[model samples]
Target: MRNGFKIISFFIDPGAIQPFVQNAGFQSGLLQTIVDDRWSETNRDVYAFWPRLSTLYNLNNNQPSTWWLRNGSFLRLKQVDLGYTLPNLKKVAIKSSRLYFSATNLFVISKFKMWDVEMGGNGLGYPVQSIYSLGLQVNL
Candidate 1:
């Protein structure tokens, strides 16, 4: 965060991007999503790793390559937990008790690029959220 303004980056450059597809790389179970003849047009190759592969293109061959923006992010706080179980109170009419115990989304952690504040998967402008809980319980 810079001056309270979130810093984000994107890819927006289109140039000759050609990756030759192995003619013999055909698989039996899963088909490759991307393949090239090594002599295709020019554009920045986008590898979002999700949904599908994307690329920018010009309407005419004489025009320059088009570009788009892609962003990968870093880890953000997912959850926090702090709790305390009540002491032995079963001697009287009361039974088990608890205090100041809370739990949030403490399982999923974001695994994206270096500027992502999202959890789990990388989305757009997903600010990392923190869950704070307070409560009291008693069993009788």
Candidate 2:
């Protein structure tokens, strides 16, 4: 694995006709290989497997979609949930009431991409942004 900023190669040739070493690979996840002063971008996800999940959402893949999930690149904000309801209902033969909040794909993991590749729509492939929910229960 390449450490620090300098290049770590297999000692074949640094300025030869073929810059790529024959059997050079990474050692572990702790080290990274930086090539040509450029880092590997989120390519795996942008080019992930587009399969048939359903008729509307992850169906044929080329169809119109509301969201797209990038694969094998980096960490991405993935769900969100928030809820609230009336209280003290369960005590009297009624459903209980409570309040809660949550978020999915809450924020983004990478700053390189402003928008997520997994997300797509007929529009311009906007992002999932944030989702919020509210609910209520009553005793009858």
Q: Write the per-residue lDDT of candidate 2 for residues 1-140, one digit (tens) a residue.
A: 12211221121111211112111112111112222222124333432323222225433444444323322134544454445454456557775554555545555444223234344222244446666544443445
Clashes of 1: 5
Candidate that would win on lDDT: 1
TM-score list, all predictions: 0.32, 0.31
**Candidate 1 lDDT by residue in tens digits, 62-131:** 2322222233333323444444566678678787766653444433332322222232222233545546
lDDT of each: 0.36, 0.35
TM-score of 2: 0.31
* Model 1 TM-score (2 dp): 0.32
Off by over 4 Å in 1: 1-73, 103-116, 119-126
Alpha-carbon error at 129 in model 2, in Å?
Answer: 3.1
RMSD of each: 14.7, 22.0
